[model samples]
Every structure is written in structure tokens, then in C-alpha cells.
Target: MPLQTVLVTGANRGLGLEFVRQYREAGWHVIATSRPLDEGVRARDCGAELLQLDVRDEGAIHALAHALEGRKIDLLINNAGYHPGAHQLGELDYSSWQTAFHINVIAPLQIAEAFLPVIPPGGKIVNIGSRQGSMACNREGGRYLYRATKAALHSITRSLAIDLTKRGIIVVALHPGWVKTDMGTDSADIEVEESVSGMREVIADLGQHNTGHLINYDGAVIPW
Candidate 1:
């Protein structure tokens, strides 16, 4: 059997890096992208092909698609994201909010569009979303920038799932649990390994029956 290939964005560290590590260990072909070329050394050490990619750069995204034009991507994990720090109502940073929208919401959709030709039928595109994006799950009221962008990303995921149905491509947004990464902080709920493993399991089980939903790492469906 031919090895399956997975392309991961923001793979320099954290959950993205863990995905590259685990997939490579599972004997899959992993193409890992990071903003800085040098930061992908760890992924390269894990036997992944490293690519420098700033998800916000449209030209770079297209160039990457062109470079890997004929290669079949069994899975594409849109893991690049940005989280503007906690801000009070009056202290909100509009600039960071726009940046977050570009990285967290728009970049994923653009990347998916650029790579559409490489992803064959039955392929999967997993957008890394957050539980904070859930309108029904919002108890606290901070992180406006991050929360808003993730919500928009979830919307995009649903729309992509519907639009790509004819082509037999599966698209879903996954919340990787509160993990012990730089973004998640040390006091988070789970380790990066556990979150990535759970998400991988969910991705493996995705099909037409469950293509357009926001799912948690543990396989529970999150309310939109």
C-alpha cells in the first residue's frame, strides 16, 4: 500500500509539530510548514519535508501549491492560527484583531482553495478551531479577537464541507482541547500528544456522514 501524505501548517512547535512527529512515526509522508524556514528543523528531524510558509502570505501559499501540484495530499491540517491576548472592553486591539482574522479565519480557507487540486476524492481538510468559538459554550467574555476569528473559521469549514461535497472531499473544524502548548499555557487541560492523538482518531473516522461539524478532540460534536 502506498503511504498516506499529510500537510500541516504552523508545524514549528506545539500541536502542529506533534502532528508531524506522530504522523511520521506512523509511517506517513509528512509535509510540515512553518513561518521561518529554520524553525522546521525538528519536523525535518522527524522525517517530514519542511517548507517555509507564512499562512498570511497568499503568494507563498500559491507557490507551495504549484510546487506540490502533482503530489496527492491525503490530509491537510490547517493548523496555523493567532490568538490576541486577553483584553478588556475598552482596551481591545483592533490591529491584532485584524491580524487574527487573517491568520485564524482567512488563511485556512485560502490554503484549502490553493491545495484543492492536490487533495483527491475522500481526502480530508481539518481546520484547527477552538471551543471558545462555540456560541453556546461561551461562559466567560474575554478573548474577543480569538473567539470571533475561530467562529468565522467554523463557518468556513461548514461552507467548504458543503461546497466540496460533489468532489468527495471532507472538511471539518476540530478543537484540540486546552493543551499544554505555548498558546494553551502550562495550566491547560491536556498534553499536546493526547490532543493530537485524539484529533487524529477523529480525522481517521471522518466521512460524508460527518463532514461539516465542529468536533472536539475527544470526538464529541461541539455546538455551532
Candidate 2:
């Protein structure tokens, strides 16, 4: 049997890198993308086909789609994200907020659209989202930029799930728990390995039944 192929974005470090490592270990064909080629040596060492991709570059995205025109992508993990740090209500930087939205929300959708032709029926698209995006769970409420962008990503996930239903594509948002990555900090609740493993299990079990939902790494549904 041919190996299943998974393409992960932002795979230079942290959770993205962990995903690439784990998938490669599982004997899957891993295609890992980082913004710059130099940063992706680890992914290449882990047996992934390292590609340079800055998700913000629309032309680059289309070019990649064309380059991989005949290959089938069984899974597409949209893991690139931007967290503009915690900002006070009055001191929010609009410029950084815009950047966050582009990275966290718009880029995923654009990438998905560009790669649609390569994702066969029953293929999956997992958008990395955050629990902070859940309105029902936002009690502390300080990361306005990150939170808002993730919420928008959740919305896009739902819309993509619906729109791609006819094509038999599955789209879902996954909240990898507060993991010990650069974004999650050293004090986070879990390790990158644990979070990615759990998410991989969730991805393995996904089907039409799991479409259009926000799910935690542990297989729990999160309220949006």
C-alpha cells in the first residue's frame, strides 16, 4: 500500500515540528513547510520532505500547489499561527492585530483553497485553533488578537466543512491543549509530544460525523 501523505505548515519548531516527527515515525509521507529553508533542517532530518513556505505569500502558495499538482495529500495540517502577545485594552497595536488575523485566520483558508485539487475524497484538513477562542471559555480575556483570530479560524473551519462536503473533504478545528511550546510557554499544562499524539488520534478517527466542529486534543468537543 502507498503511504499516506500529510503536509504540515510552520514545521520548523514547537508543535509543528513535533507533528512532523511523529508522523514520520509512523511511516507516513511527511511534507513539512517552514518560512525559510534554513530553519527546516530538523524536519528534513526527521524524514520529512522540507519545503519553504511563508503562508502570507499568496503567490508562493499557488506556486506550491502547482508544483505538487499530481500528488495526493491525505491530510493538510494548518499549524502556522501568530500570537501578538497579551495586550492591554487601551494599548492594543492595530498593526500587529492585522498581522495576527492574516496569519491565524486568512492564511489557512487560502492554503486550503489552493490545495483543494490535491486533497482527494475523504481527505482531512485540520486547522490549529485555541481554547481561548471559545467565547464560552474566555473568562480571563486578555489575548484579544490571538483569541479573535482563532475564533475567526473556527468560523472558517465550519464554512469549509460545509462547502467541501460535496467533495467528501473533512474540515475541523483542533485545539491542542496548552502545550510547552514557545507560544504555550514552559509553564503550560502538557508537553508537545502528548498534545500532538492526542491530536493524531483525533485525526485518525475523523469522518463525516466529526466535520465542522471544534475539538480538543483529547477528543472532547469545545463550545464555540
Candidate 3:
């Protein structure tokens, strides 16, 4: 049997990089994409097929879709994201808000739709979401832009899970926890290895049964 093919965006760093690395190490064929594929030596060393792709770039998505046309992609990890300055509710920067939505919410959905047909039955979509995105746990006020984008992403995940079930594809939002990445910052509680390892294990074990659910890296369900 051929190895499963997994494509992960934002592969230059953080969780995306770990997914590519670990999947490749497991003998899967990994197609790692990033805005600057040339700069990611770590991803390249993982023996992945590197592609230049910015999630916000529609043309790039189409180009990539065409490049992989007719091939069966078993898994897609939409890990690309951007969190602009933590804009308070009233003082929000409208431009940054739009940019965040473009990258966090819209781009992933567009990428998935653009490549929908090529995904094989039993394939999966792992959307990188956040706990802050969860309406069930939105306590503090502030960071409206990032929170909104992720919440929209979670909504998209639920809708797509139902819409794509006929194709036997699984779509679920995954919160990688407060990871110690550039996005998560130094004071984050979880290390990158711990977060990614837990997520990879849970992700590798998820299926159609878990579609549309919001789950933590450790496989706990989260309220929508």
C-alpha cells in the first residue's frame, strides 16, 4: 500500500513544522507548504515536497491545486494563522481585523473547498483553532479580532463536517493549547513538543465519528 499523503500549510514553523516532521518520520509522504518554502530547512530535512503557498493567496491555492490535480490527499492540516496586535473591542483596528479574518477564517475554508474533490474518502481536515475561539469559554474581554476569526473558523468546521459527510471526509477544529510558539509567546504553559505530540496522536486517531466537534490537543471535547 502507498503511504498516506498529508499536506500541511504554514510548515515553516511551529505546529505545522512538527506535523510535517512527525508525519514524514512515520513514512507518510508530506507536502509541506509555506509562504517562503526556501527558508524552511527543517521542513526540507523532513523529506517533504516543499511548495510555496500563502493561505491568503487564492492564486497560490489554485496553482497548488492544479499541481496536485488527480492525486489523493489523505489529510490536510490547515495550520496557517496570523494574530495581529491584540485589538481591544472599541479600539480595534479594522484593517487588522480584516487581515486576521482573511488568514484565519476565510483562507482555510477556501483552501479546503478548492481542493475538496481531490481528497480521498476517509480523508480528514484538521483545522487549527483556539480555546479563545470557544464561545463556551469566552471569559475575558479584548482580542476581538483574533477571537472572532477563530470562532468563525469553528463555525465553518461544524458546517463543513455536515456538508462533507457524504464524501466520507472528516472535518474538526483542534485547539493546540497554549503552545510555546511565536504566536503563543514565551509565557505559554505548554511546550511545542508536548502540544504537537498530543495533537498528532489525537489527530491520527480521529475519524468521521468525531467530525464537526471542537477538541483539544489531548482529545477532550470542547463546547462550541
lDDT of 3 by residue, 71-162 (tens): 98999999999988857756767877778999999999999998898898899998999998998898886888888899999999999999
Total colliding residue pairs, candidate 1: 0
**119, model 2: CA deviation in Å?**
0.1
The C-alpha lDDT values of all candidates are 0.95, 0.95, 0.90
How do the residues 144-194 of candidate 2 rate in per-residue lDDT, one tens digit apiece? 888889999999999999999999999999999999999889999999999
Which candidate, 2 or 3, would have the higher lDDT against the true structure?
2
Residue range 1-224, candidate 1, lDDT tens digits: 78999999999999999999999999999999999989899999999999999999999999999999889999999998888885668888887877899999989999999999999999999999999998989999887888899999999999999999999999999999999999999999999999999999999999999999999999999999
Ranking by TM-score: 1, 2, 3
Off by over 4 Å in 3: 89-91
Q: Between 1 and 3, whose TM-score is larger?
A: 1
Q: Give the TM-score of candidate 2.
A: 0.98
Cα RMSD for candidate 2? 0.8
Model 1 spans with C-alpha error above 4 angstroms: none
Cα lDDT for residue 132, model 2? 88
